[model samples]
Target: MTALMKQNIRRITTVLVSSAMSAFATVQTVGNFSVLSMNTAGLPDFLQGNDVPGDKTENHRMIGAKFVEYGYDIINVQELEFKLNLGQDFNYHAALYSTASLPYRTPTSGGVPFGSGLNTLSRYSFTDTTRVKWNDCSNFGGADCLTPKGFTLVRVLLSSSPEGYAYVDVYNIHADAGVTNADLVARASNLRQLSEYIDNWSAGNAVIIAGDTNSRYTRVRDEIRILTRENGMTDPWVELIRDGVDPTEETICANPTTLSYCETVDKMFYRSSPVLNLQAIGWSYESSRFLQPNGDILSDHNPIVATFSWSLPASLRQSELYGGPHDTWFSDTGVLSRIFSPRISTIRFRGGSRLDAVSVAHVDGTSITHGGTGGRASELKLTDGETWTEAKLCLGQRNNRTGVFAIKARTSAGRTLTAGSSTEDCAEFVAPGGWGIVGFVGGSGSEIDKLGFLFAPH
Candidate 1:
């Protein structure tokens, strides 16, 4: 095994010992810099007036270069014919695509013959996967209305660090953008079914379901929100919009107006227990004026990119100190982190030696420290709460190693008779992976047994 692997094995041993002792620990860091893009809109048949009818390989290279510029790790592409060679040029270790056959039409001069489907690319390794296909092509009528075959699901292991194994599910789809409403509903149902499948297999796994749903209408976006959000999933784009993300033009349809860049048709969505930080989101619509002797643009749909940072619970430390689940759990399609109370007393932590550091969650009046852990600790404190409240543990570097440890609770007034810091009394519960929070309540005669530790790592 490699050095990292050896360290992982050693940590597992420590975790076993720590669980015997108490438990606890997280990032898909946004600053890592990543992007996802697509829309070569290639079709099987040829046509006369269609100058560049979107070639799958050309689109792939263009999107890949865009990602390279922005330092993106993942790319979701749509309208790929599956015939393009990705053997070495793309350089993705784990890639997934669907062969959803579509009717062959006339091809544009010098363009690809024709094909249909979606594809996903990743630089990281992938494990535990599934593929889903849809049948909405029937919605289109007559010889001109060609229905698409379906979609695909590819699940990847996000982290197998000393802390735990987390996952992310990516789905690539090219829904019939020609129709709306019921057709969109059918596609949404199909996606939901896939989500349910993942839920059954990996309960607490992070998921990213994206594609060219062709649901550019307001209703379709709403339906998507319901399918994911109602099921505990969060849309990374919507989250970015909430965080104030700006949009860029990737494709421009030539019209008399010359100002026809419209619709957020292509997209990428994610849902999970961890707080997914919306790092960057934008479309690829740079001008082609510099590329040709006579300015010419390629492709119809501009590829879209979305970057995320995973923020899971801190319960792993507690689990290590006390013992946590070897498997995972999910609320629906999203993973579930251990719940922590604003008020804390006991900290069931994992690996920690005299050389390692540990910090406690502190509460000051109305503020909370989220349990900061690093270096040595004399006593863990939270911003004082007149009312019993819960907070999180902020553990730093020593995070990945240290097992669970214990923390004694006392009033700022120096009264120790009130609370007992023990996972046994606190009803210790493990967070799905290894991050979570402890719950504490305050009263004249408060029950301190409910007080536990909530830890989140990096």
Candidate 2:
């Protein structure tokens, strides 16, 4: 059972090896609060099984100090010391009162915790609070039900928001752990119960649900789907996937080869629009920075955080993205013969001839002129919702002629970038100057889709 605990309980220790992290794309932090979720296996001193078995009260205290130093607005902590009679020895109470003194805090759930070991620290006072233990967890087959693995929900003022939506509902959850059929079923039940609670508690208000979900992103099927697709909550990480990139490439795992290093179980789910005037401007996972003063990760799971700005600008609004106007047409030599080497004269301006929309989208389309000649393109029109700071596109070519795709971006200042003679396609560029024209210059013929993208201005 001890070995099984170590094998299954990932919140006790981290596996981050010393390695420089690779750079990811910069995100625009418009008007969102910084929120975090981590499962701190502070109970059962040997949870991490690294050193002698003894109370790690000091380590837990220091972890709280780290959170204070991070200056985030909200944090959801899981798996703290649950021994009720420990009094002063209780690390959770000490950690909270010690380093987190300045920020407003949530009152610790009273009564013997039954081991929920869950708590939320925030920068604002709670307007409403609700806590409940899972009705589905059990300890007979595994040690899951020993602790009260449940969830907490509260509402706080997003004082930083300019959109007048200061009240935001927040749900902090810790689900059952394991891979057996029983474990999976238990987790599924917990999720359903949580979702139902969300539905019953509020009328689809502005909400952010986060914590150690204990679900794997790589799993073919799991409870996360219920929380996301079915529940209508947006996964910020998924929303931030760069245009034209595979969704799987975006990960909380640092080493994919072994699945041994940094992996993700922590998540943040949110909503924006009619009820919640929040927009997710940025999202990232704590990798290199996932450490304590002693240079080791404070917890086994990497922290995932997202930035939301309620006072978002026109460009950062959610509706600005017009994903699939998918107007497609191509010219082949046989019937729909369209000439090759289309000059700026032939470039198709989305939403009309002037390219006057907030942003334009393009894609290398189905070839028509010949089997591999004329490159086809898609047209796009940008409207409302999330504005961006940059424009990007992907370009492909044929082996017959020199594959050259010409792109022209013209600014209000008349400054222009010309991609007249370049083999380089499939790339990103600053978009202070909105695009004017996109067409093929050389290359026997090339198809282009995802011709343009908009990156929100930070």
Candidate 3:
């Protein structure tokens, strides 16, 4: 019962939907960023060359220099291949070393053509790319939908913090391999058209689904708890398995040919909106380190690496009285909060214009106003048609209940609209775990000085 569990038993189709019971919510551990997903079977029936050993293009350049020796800014791969003229190759160095990419191959051919077996490599700088080929794959991966396996979205950015600019919105998939019946209806139409093409995008941004999920979590049909409780996403080694992932190797190489299989189909999930907070989770299963000078084990699936730490609504803005979030009521606790946490996305509040509209409260004061005739009960105008430079807010309020969040900014002609509070509502909005976008700036005294947040092409 090996060979990747014989690609999941052969024939089973149920679409279960029950798994993710609830557990992982203890975030914050200290991390900057890193992510890597691999399935480098190096397709075209895995170029059998000497039946798996050295020179599989030097084992894909030693697996792309061991993912740059595990530095990883972003790298998702699948069978990967593309051949025009040794230009821009990819996925295990462009399909098992035909050329141009992988482990660390980006000599320009990013135009992505030739064979394109789902490849994404980055050191940062990403955009709105989207690709999902599979129409209705045949069976046992139908030669992997003949070269366009499926799944990719991009977003990336990942840095520049003072309290913002750490974007992410990567999807990267590889579904549709077994359980017959046309591979369970093309893996449920690749999880319902990749959750309806990321459901029109913008939920407070910041998502990272990861890949190679040949569907598990107690199968049923590998609905995978409908993408973690209806696309709320967050698996981190199965719902934060007692301090989730974070392993370089403490011995648990569970199975997949003995290097930590444990039902390995390759997965890694993340989501935020309860105001950004997946601060830690680590992993590495480089299949016992590259090897293969004929020693073996380089790509038959076993790249699996992960590491992350997020929770920086601008490094936790202090909500001011001197340290933010004081709110002394009528007595005026200095009145200047900046709580942070936005994980639903769809935020766009560019430069600034007349200044004065930036309020969305909930440190118990509850706010999300602007329904009609100058609405403002608990406060939440959120740039009500300010047309300042640009405005649009959609913080995760579908049932708001995370913690400490305030966004006060009002003082146009009264003077101070140019001092501090650039209308980004006090922070704390993570917990959606699927959408994408994250960036911020928290410093300015009153009239709202330079504010930010984008990823809302919604």
Candidate 4:
């Protein structure tokens, strides 16, 4: 550690750090998108015209015009089925589909007695679309079994970041209608089936579930809680409009246009993933936008809309982030660390049997630290030309909560640093080809709750 050597190190660190910061500024991803969920009430022309004002064919044209005007990024509509025998030329489904402005859309799952009546329109491209019919249906009060009422799932390509293409699993569902005991039982089964489907198909992915649930938070028999309780989804109406409070009983909206007092069955839910972070920034009931010339309502149920802002790490590439969902998320990019050419200079850890804290210092002299300060402290310093090439983490119960229990870092020069207790549930992350681990991302609080690596070229 001579004076001239220290001066040279500082100069090199400054140049590398500055370059990393500049690169990060160009790759950061942040943007806002909007979604609309509506039940178009696209029943048979005779049945639909009797229930809602105006002709079914004309109403569909009006609804589609509004959808185009609103410019929603994603649109979920239920009861949009068409039956050829019921007058193909005058079908409401065809009228609505023809006027939609969104460039991308899901084709009708089926016709009348067979279709799920669920469709999704989006501004972005989507793939892997699938529709599942509910196993349970109620014939006591509503003819729910006459049609294949169920849900549709689509993986939408939201945007592209340095990490990869950001994708979200969007679900649109229409549950059994009515409030009879048999109907309640059927709706409960519908929600449970959807919960299981999400767990099985959309695991570890960001998701947005919305449509005519035909269930309410205040209704005890709705069982709408299963989506949140079982799958960790957030209801934007409850979170943003209701102030995170569930009304004890059905709330009568004095003015539905305000969107503050209404608890419509048409609802929306969302959940974020380790790769993408989603936050509901705005919500509206959309009462005025869908009105006719004389101010007639569009359908039996008003359209509900939600606006979300998303963000992801600005790294060249990232390993799968691991941990529980109970802490604040952080990324090395927030601290101006470069994810392309930076190298890890030092890694410090504090823990005994469970990792309590982690601190990483880069070649640029900028360091990012996370977690608490309760465990013993240890540090690993890499010499010139040495860099971390692999990381192993054990994720398990710590203080009854899921978190990082152990960590091991191995360098290109063969030096190793280890901490905490290794367990059966362990995951290893290795840099590919000429890449090396240079930074970190994940959730952390009093202890290191989550852990993931960011890679850069040597």
TM-scores of all predicted structures: 0.49, 0.55, 0.31, 0.66
- The residue ranges of model 3 lying beyond 4 angstroms of the native Cα positions read 1-36, 40-65, 68-70, 76-157, 161-166, 178-181, 195-197, 200-291, 295-297, 301-401, 410-458
lDDT of each: 0.40, 0.51, 0.47, 0.80
Off by over 4 Å in 4: 1-28, 48-50, 86-90, 253-259, 313-458
Clashes of 3: 71
Candidate 1 per-residue lDDT over residues 1-458, each given as its tens digit? 79999999999999898675444322322133244655554443222222553443443354445444555466556555433243423211111122211121112112122233455566655533334445434354211124344555555444433343444656666655444455655656655655565555434445666666655435543255554544565555545543433233233334111332344556666655443223334433233311222334445554455656554333322221121211222221121233233334433222223112222332322222222243243543333432212232221122343222333333333432121122332222333332334321110111111122323431
For candidate 2, lDDT tens digit of each residue in 1-458? 69879875554444321111111111231345888776765555423332422335655666677777778788887776355564344445556457665466666554234657677888876644667888897554457776778998776665422121245678999888777788788888888888877665543346798898887666534467676655678877667743312244325564111232334767788875332367787777754454555565556666677777764333321111111112231211111113222112211322211111221222224221211223233332322322223333324333432121444444333433333323344344443322222221111212332222222222
User: Which regions in candidate 2 have their CA more than 4 angstroms from the true location?
Assistant: 1-30, 46-55, 84-90, 110-115, 140-142, 160-165, 241-263, 312-458
- Residues 399-432 of candidate 4 have per-residue lDDT tens digits of 6789998899899988888888888999888775
Clashes of each: 82, 39, 71, 0
Candidate 1 has a TM-score of 0.49
TM-score of 4: 0.66
Candidate 2 similarity to native, TM-score: 0.55
Residue 368 of model 4, lDDT score: 74
Candidate 3 lDDT, 1-458, residue by residue in tens: 79666655442222222112122222222246777887765542233332454444456666766766656778787655533334333334443344323333323223224444566777777654666566656547455554566777775665533223455678888887777777877787777767766544524455787778677655666575577666677776654453443333333333234434354667877776433455436765666665565556767666666677776442322111111211111111112123233322122121222222233333334332111122122322223222111122221111222211223222211211121122344442221222222233221223222233322111
Alpha-carbon shift of residue 357 in model 4 (angstroms)? 34
Candidate 2, 106: how far from true, in Å? 1.8
Pick the lDDT winner: 4
